[model samples]
Target chain A: MSLTLETNLEDPDAIYEKLIAMLESHEPEKALRASARLVLLLINHIGDRKVIDEAIERAALLTEA
Target chain B: MNVETGKAAWRETIPVWRAFEPSPKPETEFEQARVVIVGTGPVGLAMAIDLGQRGHEVIVLGRFDFVPAGSKAICFSKRSLDILDRLGCGEQAVEKGVSWNIGKVFWKDRSDPVYKFDLLPVKNQKMPGFINIQQYHMEDILLDRLKQLPNVQIRWGHEVTALDTSEESAIMSVDCADGAYRIETEWLIACDGNKSSVRDLMGLDFEGRIFEDNFLIADVKMKEDRPSERWFWFDPPFNPGQSVLLHKQPDDVWRIDFQLGWNIDREACIKPENVNPLVRAMLGDDVEFEEEWYSVYTFQCRRMQHFWHGRVIFAGDSAHLVSPFGARGCNGGFADIDNLGWKLDLVLEGKAPFDILESYDSEAIVTADENILNSTRSTDFLTPKSDISRAFRDAVLDLAEDHPFARALVNSGRLSTAISYPDSSLSTADADVWSGGIAPGSPALDAPLDNGWLLEKLGGRFVLLTTTPFADLPSGLDVLDIAQEPANGLLRERYDLQGGGAYLIRPDQYVAARFRQPTGAAIADALARAMGEQA
Candidate 1:
């Protein structure tokens, strides 16, 4: 993907899709950690605590880290 | 079907195994399984399992071959478990998911705040307060239970592409990857997910705006030792800053996320090395971790204009998509299965009119609005926008320090416990006040119901109960007794009962209403709403 961190500001959907694809395809641990990233991006784009909270929930599951 | 004997679980207690018996093709379309549900993904599988168990010669379309990833239905409430128990999946579902009683709320570098939700206080909700089993695992359990039934046939690789629920007894035209065929049936129910092809083919309108938040979720192996309780760290949580959340799942796996207060490159955020700093910040300076998987996502809080279009009804994410904060999206679909199961059985068996299908609309809408909409409101408060909203949230979070009630509110939102549908017509009563225990219109509790059974007794149909010292239950409805506490104002206000009161329950287990002693008439009205056209 050509998008940089700055250019990626407008798209939360694409970000989520990419992350979901990763979680669906990768190891359980990383997929779990990525959930926090997912929530952080969402809070920035959507600013919805519910979504961010849900995302953070998935993150905490990655092997007690 | 008979409830199993002696300490038997819900799966064993339900006698669905006898219901899936094969039926001979009859003259009328309804004679056969009028509706054949595909892939019991909370929605489809639930439809097949519930209908099959209920005795509607329903067929399921799915390949039990592929093992699903993580458990999907991670969070199930007391009410949800009761619904599942009625359907025979409760014991197993409850047993499979870990019960969580305590939650930790953190604001980035701020001190940790702890909150406890005592699900035990409620009468009907029992052990395994909340469950977190994978969706696929739960589906497996439900399908196995369906196997015990005789009439339900599960068709694997049954990817239904073109649906023709266009007629009164709609015909579904499905094209599986292997081959294709046209199956003529009475009605069509779509349990498919958000991008539902079934809904698309029908050209129905899914009305609601998609929220702007994009979320990225990753599961990884980490070496940091953390409590099993969920951790919510708000950044500038006390002030104005980004947020981070961390959680633990089965298999030494952890799920973590950053509120990406600003949209950033998905790749950059997920870089193997990039995640180390965040991990160190959240876990400690010296925690070691390995990467597992990563990705990004966005949010949308939308619901269909019509949960039902003619015979093709929608359930699960197809009917509605709630923000995940409350875990409502998946749980809500399970509600659809609970709602449609018995009614479809009655109609398919000619026990009741087909109009009963209409109740799905009212019940689902109210359920979604009360649960999903309320969740969104809570989300806005925590993840506020503009300076004012954030300031307001900070103020609320700050309240947790001194006020127990404020702490309760913060915890309730996290526990996803504020969902109520008192306004639902399905939940009804005459002019009344409220009281202790529960007023007439409430969901069933895990506590005891009359005759040795608890909430499990009223699983299959709408039931009405009396509260006073009496067992004079109306025939054909499940009834329970409620002894009103004289001093409880909430109960008094709810039932309008001067002293004594009773309650009525829907098949899905929400209370219809409470009454003084005369519960029969109020029950009839509640049943009338539930029966709507179905009766």
Candidate 2:
């Protein structure tokens, strides 16, 4: 699947799914696998530090899962 | 609909309701709605949105005349984000909310140290760490979505002065400042917050002790250079009588709390003139400031022993009011809505019995107790008055400076995540074995769902999650991009989870179980346990 550059990036579900992929990954080459920075950029745009924390945990878990 | 650039999606014009306007006709004249909710805060409004979207008529009684300001719970759990998703407002709420993870727990005489919530194990995809959104803004988003619900009604300034809950339905009497009208509904939910009049009318005992110390919460806008982190400061580590927590709100705003010893005057904190000095003390003297909110109140860990009496149920501050350390108050109310919503549907449609109401009380009481325990423990660690507790807390800070293992222990508890109710009739199976089944009752691991489906499909009903618990993965479940190697064997059997350790998740996104084959009959046993069907 190709990234659509979704504009609704600040949406919590979007951030959750994006971060989930990042969190569930345990295999090597995550950066090559998916773009975590894009997710961060979206969260950064909203300036909600709390949501950012949740997304970060989800991202890490995505990789681990 | 014209999709214009730079305009809010759906061009949803935000309404500034200066004051509430009531209809001339009596409320009883209107059709009896399916659900009538009191209080229009995040909990009530969110429930209205959920029920309305689910095709039920709802009436939301907003108690106050004005939209209350300042910071409420700024941080949200991943489960909350999922609930927001189910309500069709996830896009707007997430768009407006900011992501944050860096948090600091500091001791007095010691500098602040940052801990990242991002470092914790992620539970689901499509959700971020947590969002820092002012509670008022969250209410605004909810109100907007609520307006879109054709079947929903928001009567601001209408207080529910009296209600009669019987097996047949709920009859309510709403009192405006001037007059009152009656509302008959199939069910009534009290989200009226702490000091809830609805809970009071029911004559239910709110059992809990109030802490001797009072807290001062101040919201300020200042041009200060400090790293963005949710910080807890227990100053003068040895006799740390006072504590402070700093939450960064949007637009150069910070929510700061001073946990002054309970003996201080409450007026000394709420007085607007006294706030400036306190702001300068925290952020340094050089920064100019704009003060938005400042108030003082003592903390209490209290909850109604029974969440429901007859047809009415309680939520949020009404059901339980714990210390703010864990952000449990409003979110707990949300969990109530999630549990009650689907159950209400079942009852109205004759799929379940009226006694199912018992689960709400039993389950929510357990949740309130757990929240109180966690908050009290966190508060003790954050603001230790006793010498022993202070010393123990100091040790963690000392360890944070050098030892990695010690730091890990210090940062172990996920304070903001919503808790699980594995003991409820909603959950099935005994404690067997599974990777995610670390405890007897724990939230199910957010297992993979259907394509394009996130964790939300499980909300509004009970969900059973299971992991096969294998180092090697099955080809079918393994094929999905989100699939995982089983966590372990123990989790599979402990929760009676099939394949990977399965978790029985409640509709509001709480865990019911996390194991494999813990019971012979999956749904029946779990439902029986949740509903108190078994002896």
Where model 2 places Cα greater than 4 Å from the true spot, the runs are A1-65, B1-18, B22-33, B109-120, B223-227, B236-241, B395-400, B403-414, B430-444, B447-453, B457-506, B509-535
- Superposed by TM-score, candidate 2 places the C-alpha of residue B184 at a distance from the truth, in angstroms, of 2.8
Residue B395, model 1, lDDT = 47
Tell me the tens digit of each residue's lDDT in model 1 across B1-535. 1224322143332222122222222333222347766554666876776777666677665422243453233566655666677778878876666555445676546574634445435433344455655565576677777778888766644556666655466666554433456677676777768878777887875777666655556566776566655666666342237655555655466776566644677678767676666655556666667665655556667888778677777888888877666667777777777777766767667756766666667777777776667667756755676555554455445555665645654622444442455555445545665545454345555453333344555566666545555444556775543453233333334434446656666666666665554555555665666554322
Q: Give the per-residue lDDT digits (tens) of candidate 2, residues A1-65.
A: 22233575558787788766775673443332233333323544555666667666766789987
Docking class of 2: incorrect
DockQ (Cα-based) for each candidate: 0.02, 0.01
Judging by lDDT against the true structure, name the best candidate: 2
Q: What local lDDT does model 1 show for residue B527?
A: 66
B1-535: candidate 2 lDDT, tens digit per residue: 2234422232243223343554333545334777888888889898888778777878788766556665566766565776787777766776887656556666566664633345236533566656667888888888888878889878866777777777878887776645677888888888888878887787776787677777788878776767655677656452355677777766677888877775777777678777676667776666788877777766788877788777787888988887777677776777677667766666666656787778777877887888888777766666566755555555555545554444543532336565656565655555554443334345433433444343544545554443333333222121112234333233333333335434545555555444444333554455445533444
TM-score of 1: 0.72
